[model samples]
Target: MRKHHAQQLYDYHVWANDKFFARLKELPEDIYIQEIQSVFPSIAETLVHMYMVDTIWLGVMKGNSMAEIQASIASVQEITKDNQLQKMEKLFQDLSAEYQTFLHHESDLDKEISPEHPQFGRLDTQLSELVQHVVNHGTYHRGNLSAMIRQQGYASVANDYVFYLYEGKAEK
Candidate 1:
């Protein structure tokens, strides 16, 4: 079962992202959106970029039109709202649902997807890798987001996978 391992990883990632963002909301709005020394431009912009790119890659892996994912995110960047916390929740929810559907439909663990990455060139990867990459990608930016927020003097909860495993509901 390739699917089992991949799904397990996906479950862990969804668990981690949800908890991470929930704690992220505790930080003041200004701090969360603030620019500081980060892996990306600003915490806010990077977070948007993370979700957008992830959907693109995931869409490509699942044979979904990457354009839809691109357009969905391009719409958000045009005008980010003040209620960013709500927006983040929506993004997470959508990603969670999409990934869940992907897992269910892709029951074959050995399935392969070869997609060309603009930066990395062509990638011949397992579905497991694609699923894991999105989670890892999001977590990296979430870390960037946390650090950026704290640089402006805001506190954040630890959003690690181990923390989620010990503390939160994982089956949802």
Candidate 2:
């Protein structure tokens, strides 16, 4: 994939994330932390998981091992919906900037990354593929978050890629 393509995908990822977070904020604070039976136990846990995965992929792109990335975000164990939105927002901003910078500087889309997973061992993949995976991963969890919101009797935000396109975001 081209850098511009990855950039557009990342742009949409950020926009969608913001829209989801806005809707999440509209709910009563207690709902954010309420445990439910899903991919994650609660909206807050799902959001934190998304942020942590993004950080992991970003760390891998920067040449850090998965173990290293996990170690870095270990402090997040104590984070909760009650006390972590501000910090998570900062992470969102920083990761977005880092992604944009990575796209700007990398000339090769085919460069390989083989981040080691402790349980699964190592799998070789292209940089551009991983970039796409990160966006897809976020989209999936955001859908989960939406379901959790509705389970709490609140309306969730629409963050579909079509909506992002209809907002006049540049496609090229």
- Candidate closest to the true structure, highest TM-score: 2
Over 4 Å off, model 1: 1-3, 65-83, 118-120, 168-172
- lDDT tens readout by residue for model 2, 1-172: 3236777888899999989767766768788889988889987788888887887788887778666787868845555345456566676777788888887788876689787778899879988788889999999999998899898888899899889989967465
Worst 10 residues of 2 by lDDT: 75-84
**Model 2: per-residue Cα lDDT at residue 38:** 84
Which residue pairs of candidate 2 clash?
Answer: none
TM-score of each: 0.79, 0.86
Q: What is the lDDT of residue 6 in candidate 1?
A: 67
Show where candidate 2 strays beyond 4 Å. 1-3, 78-83
**Cα RMSD for candidates in order:** 3.2, 2.5
Model 2 TM-score on a 0 to 1 scale: 0.86
